[model samples]
Target: MQSLKEGLLNRAFSHIYVEKRAMEYELTKEILKRFKESKVIEIEHYKDIFSRANQDFYLQKKSPKLILAVKQNNLIYKGADVCEDFGNKHFYYTSIMMNCIYDCEYCYLQGMYTSANIVIFVNLDDYFKEINRLLSMHPLYLCISYDTDLLALEGLTNYVKKFIEFAKENSDLTIEIRTKSANFNLIKHIQPQDNIILAWTLSPEGVIQKYEHRTPNLKRRIKSIKEALDRGFRVRLCFDPILYIKNWRDEYRDLIEEVFSNIDADKIYDVSIGLFRVSKDYLKRMRKQRPDSIVLNFPYDTVEGVCSYDKELSRNMIGYVYGLIARYVEKEKIYI
Candidate 1:
């Protein structure tokens, strides 16, 4: 079978740009009419669909499968550390959307959701109100792009800019927009907020070419990051899910040097590091769905439901990268 890139964007309706208030049902109807023969996975009726360990998203992640875009529900978790530690702080994260625009084979979304259909929770005010209520007690560090790359879908959903505006008013809240998108146009519209940190996930050029699928290349991402930093955005680097590839050391060394060479290290807020990892349940589904994926086929050790490189390899990779990064960034700014 040909790669998804063969004609990923050829089907015009595959990516429908809609206004924020456009009813998801109406959008679904429009999509279904456009691709009447395609499958539709109705997610509004399928609550807790992603929580299922054995869910197969590839079956439903396609045209006409309109996952109802609902308001982000409850649970304002602020007690889990999201930055440097595995699980340390009370930083909170809430998902305003589900699924992503890019189709990265290594992404856990395929295993986490039963539908590939994008779901945009139209009720943004509800989340803002909820955060306000939570902020009554403690300052919150909210991860807005944890579940979806809001930047990539900015043309359809202007959530990030809205969130930035929201943060400009709510100075007590720390908002992080983590993304793999090269959509710098969206970031340009809004002024950089002191509390809003733009986090970009970086991978070596080879790794991105081999596994990242529709996401922007490393150079594009770096260019975007540099632009944001130059414009005074509090930028964070995420060297995450570091894959152990052939001559990975040389590749990553070059990547690190290349990154620091382009951007001002002093202006950077911090750098986050994490080895490749995913739930074993998610891995099983992806492996079966994409048997040809080298990322899935690689040997991984399972701890509970999470599958990652063996402990030794994971440690060595992080340690080596940490040492390489220490040369450019301060010890305090590095998070592992």
Candidate 2:
């Protein structure tokens, strides 16, 4: 018999929700093969299960089920003002998946989605076609894996491989795949492309252990970034959404030193810094979902429907971190 700790550590989804149309695709079959033990339940639409009322996002996260579905309308959206556009005129983001594998206490997904189950949109051709349409007019900058960690799901989804191939073929389309995963082995074989930026969101070790649950440690993420840089990939370091914790100045300062120590500062494509901010609606939902999370319980100020640190504190935090990072890299290479 498996010990209690062993059972918890080895806990995989025992249930999988499949859209009836998704069964027609090979990707769905491939994913199902990996989760052969999971009981498959077919449904007409993913939203039927995903958008249900009063679903326990917290409980479902314990052993979240997987949903394979075909994406419908609104495949691509203009990037939100909250995100850094990096001077791209045509900044946009797409959700090939909803919800993330990691259960970070500060993640907005808890408030954005009613359920915590991972929803994988199996239809890639539609997304690519839409991008091609947009590219026909002008150059495009898209974040493909913004909603979920494609690298972490590479073993099952292989979406990262497909997106990389797509980017290679379309030189006009620049893609940013952001992740907190240390799963570099998944893309180690693929040659890096100039237009593709693999952005890694690094948090302090203390923050990761306390608030960012299930995420790779700071050292592991830095190591992954170093490996990616060594492999000729254009890597972007994101210190955005810097949480306010005890001794935050020292924690983040030490983190920056550790990052530059392991990775070559000159090789980084760029660094992005932003203080923690969430939509007013999302924060309300998050508070209800995680009542005890100190990361989410901060007395943030609401500015135009977004909740974040007060102007003075926000400026101080961003300025301090930016100064620390600028010491290692050129100021022009850092984005606010």
Best by lDDT: 2
lDDT of 1 by residue, 181-280 (tens): 9987676867887999999999999988888877899999999998898888999999997888999999999999999999889999999988878888
Q: Pick by TM-score: which candidate is best?
A: 2
User: What lDDT would each prediction earn against the true structure?
Assistant: 0.76, 0.90
- What candidate 2 gets wrong by more than 4 Å, as runs, is 1-10
TM-score of every prediction relative to native: 0.84, 0.96
- lDDT, candidate 1, equals 0.76
lDDT, residue 268, candidate 1: 93
Model 1: worst 10 consecutive residues (lDDT sum): 79-88
Q: What are the per-residue Cα lDDT tens digits for candidate 2 across 1-336?
A: 435544664245678889999998999998888878889999999989999998988877877888899998999999999999999999999999888889989889998989999999999999999999999999999998878888888888888889999999999999999999999878989989999999999988998898888889998898888889989999999997798899999999999998998889999999999888999999999999989888889999999999999999988999899999999999999999
**Native-referenced Cα lDDT, model 2:** 0.90
